[model samples]
Target chain A: MIKNVYDDEVPKVVTIKETVIETPTVKTFIFPFEITEDIHPGQFVMVWDLNNEKPMTISVIDKKNNLMGITVRKAGPFTENMYENMGVGDKIGIRGPYGHGYELSGYKKVLAVGGGSGIASLAPLLSFYDNVDLISAASTKDELVFVEKFKKENIQVHECTDDGSYGFKGFSTELADELLKTGDYDIIVGCGPEIMSYKLLELSQKYDIDCQLALDRYMKCGLGICGQCCIDDTGYRVCVEGPVFDKEQLGQLSEFGKYRRDAAGSIVEY
Target chain B: MLKSNILGMNLKNPLFLAAGILGTTASSMKMVARAGAGGIVTKSFSLEANDGYENPTIVKIEGGVINSVGLASPGVEAKKEELIELEDIRDETPVIASIYGDSEDVFCEVAQRTKDYVDAFELNVSCPHAKCGFGSNIGEDPEMTYNIVSSVKDSIKDVPIIVKLTPNVTDITEIAKASQEAGADALTLINSVGPGLRIDYQTGKPILNNVLGGIAGPMIKPIALKCVYNTYKTVDIPIFGVGGIKDYKDVLEFMYAGASLLQIGTSIMYDGPEIFKNITDDLSIFLEENGYNNVTEIIGLSHEL
Candidate 1:
């Protein structure tokens, strides 16, 4: 009857309560019962679809009604299978709520930026901060997700699309840079592509604002054991030390936006 | 119940975290020690910082994993920071530094730099995917193994030296004997096997970024056991057996095969850090049930027949 996911390595089988298609490529899966472990906004959980296991950020955590949700984009073989084979009531394996999440306790005013499916990890931060600004970006208006949801949460929203099909015409990082100059926020947080995060880190340094970022890397184990997710030079495992890191820590990374290793540990251009 | 002594260092148990897994950082290694490991063998490091290989360093096969991480390290100076962090646990939990280099001078230099920070040294002469002349290249030759181990041994007499050997060699016992004759206090058998390859069905490209990588997991357990068994018969020093250990049954098999201490690597990914605690508990129970006084009783029992 142990409730903590970290107590066991084997994944728990949970029934899919519902599925909300946020965009053509992204969907939020709802599980019936709350995983009793305390989970934070930016932390993630590993989803085992029998074929493979991949980490997905926990997009929604509803503790009161016994519900938890993970937002996933159809990125590869594993996610593609999730979109095609999974349905309401279908049993899937899940473990974790792993890694450190966003720490927003002391900040007075905060701005959060997310690009594409990266928005999923930043969505829950809105609940923790009363004075917050959020930017959701995608390639096009049709692909921009959670806009209506953020609006409903009474937070200010800025939507960006690459094709000029949405609110801002440029990339989300450009918009974030503009905001950094105009706003007097004490803290900034972001999740998205590495390029966007790298830009945000630069802006944070330029604006003298503390910034935290959620990173993605190739990981076999969500725990810190596997060195696959380690960042070059720093040797920090994104699975353990991060997935969420602040400005000071992100500064030490040499490969920030330039490159990333593929599944085979071969470096590829980011 | 699992307590044992290897190379004059007292361990609470025979299970130690193998080199190159979670031992990259002090905090991570400390976490594993807190979880129940008796000692920690750090990820192999060299004199200069190396970026190692690009991703796709590791891939999953049916029963194990292949990795070509290329021994990515932050060099001896940066690694010293992590070793300093482990200094507090040097008394209760032994910290063994695993170092590698291309020549005897390089090996001696790394050992000399790190000797003060750790309880012992593990010469990583066995990494299958390491660049030419560094890992198995130095270990595959008896004279090379003797030269590297003797050089390292000469540099640090205060701490015991354990030479990690490769199984890809023609005869592992020959290399083991060479290391022992060269004054190595202990030996860690079978650093991953093969320059194994896997392919992406769609791309028709090799799965590992390096094209070929060292293999480790349950599938290599039998081979590792045989290596340890044969080497134990050839050498007098304690053997540190590693490769494909997942549970207590594997631990017993290794112990009975003449491994004085055991190292768990790939299984830590599948079972998490809890694997240490779980295996120790099961081993304690197994010892009591079988009327064994301690873990040392089973060492080399398989050779009795």
Candidate 2:
């Protein structure tokens, strides 16, 4: 079985078996990984390309086919490189299904909110969670991810767009606000920009529903060894204690939605 | 009781969160302090922000890791902002700013800018992988070590000064003695050992972006012990022993080898930040079993043998 990956082993090289264009800027690369029972949603893996190593969330985990996927949004030099150059049959080194993934057990109904590329992080949960209402929101209809994939699973999807070209025309938070007034969701899970997660946190509190957020920060050494992604106030390592944190846990982080450190550890106002 | 006094800071125990790992930020350092480390030594920073190397700057090997983080820092000015947040925790869990530079002037400048926020300065002149003659280049030579330490000591006085030495030198004691004579309050024996390599069989390329990086973790413990042991015999200053320390047994060996205190790095990757409390708890039990009242009593006991 593929157990919890530690840094002790060299990154396992896997060839891309399939590739799908999820959006105008987003693409999903599929590969056959053996015994991926250890990987979980919200947890990320360090993808080693020809040039460098970066952390990407596990988007698709198919146990039966033993296939895994990473949905990449073309952002920055590394991902832009992946968009322009990386393709099927290309060998990429992958280590870990690392860090804390979302814990959605015990809850009956889950209201999942994914903004833009963040749907990639929430996709693994859609397979595990039976009762899920996903609000897939984006700048435009073409920028949305994983809507059809969720529909194929009979998962209810609420499509949201900013320009009114889709079903629900508004911010994901606005659509989620309307849903919360009627939907009896026990838990509200969010993955997106810190601003979107922040709004989701507020909505969860407004409805008194439990909330979990998958946050993004500068990450290196997907293992907790490097303090690159550590958060404020509590000093919790985002690489270990989180990538996923509950509403109460999010309350401890003062830097959330306000700022985050760069590669130089200098604060950049968001 | 694990309470001890060394380097003028009243520490609850002898264990410190070593520099170079998890010492990157104020929040992270605060996390280690809360995890029960007696002191926090920050990752080395300098006058200008350094991006370090590209991707794959670190890789896992047999016993530990080879890291080429390239001394990535936000410069002393930006780093001072992080350190300012640490100042509140300084009285309880003392913060040690680990600073490095290309020359003595930069070293002293960094120490001067940060002396207010930190309880001590760990001069990381021994980082084996840093480029541009910054890390071990200055630490390997006794005269250069003296120049930096003395210059830093001259610029600052209230805070303790620590020179973290590299083991790749001909005789570590020469550098240790130079640090002591130059007014360093203490010494930290050994940064990571060799600028080692781990080549990918598929691509035939080194795993680290820098190709070579310093080796750290369990394999280097004995080497660290010996460095601390030999330097202990030559210098009067207390030594902060670090290298592949995983548990309480390693802690005891370091104390016996003449380290008055300890720092745990690298192994924090294997275990979590909880390594501090785990080792300290086991150490307390070990001390109780041995009829020791204070951990200080065990320091340098191996010397008499």
> Which lDDT tens digits does candidate 2 get at residues A1-270?
112223366677889999988877998999988745677888888888855898898898888899989999999898888887889999888877778888988998898999999988887887777777788899988888876776676767799999878879889999999989997898899899889999998888889989999998887677678687888878788878888998899988899889998887778899
**B152-177 per-residue lDDT for model 2 (tens digits):** 99999899999999999889999999
Ten-residue region with minimum lDDT total, candidate 2 chain A: A1-10
Q: Alpha carbon lDDT of residue A132, candidate 1?
A: 73
- Clashing residue pairs in candidate 2, if any? B217-B244
Off by over 4 Å in 1: A1-224, A228-237, A240-270
- Cα displacement (angstroms), candidate 2, residue B146, comes to 1.6
Please give, for residues A110-214, the per-residue lDDT of candidate 1 as tens digits.
889999999899888776557778889999998988866766766678999999997999999888888878887898899998888888898888888899999
Residues B1-305 of candidate 1: C-alpha lDDT, one tens digit per residue: 77777777889998899998977667668778887998999989989877677544655455667778788877898788879978988777899999999998898888888888998999999899999889999899999999889888788889999999999988999999999999999999879999788765433556555778898888899999999999989998999999888889999999889999999887776666778999999999999999999889999999996
Clashes of each: 12, 1
Two-chain DockQ for model 1: 0.11
Candidate 2: where are CA atoms >4 Å away? Answer: A1-7, A151-155
TM-scores for all predictions? 0.67, 0.97
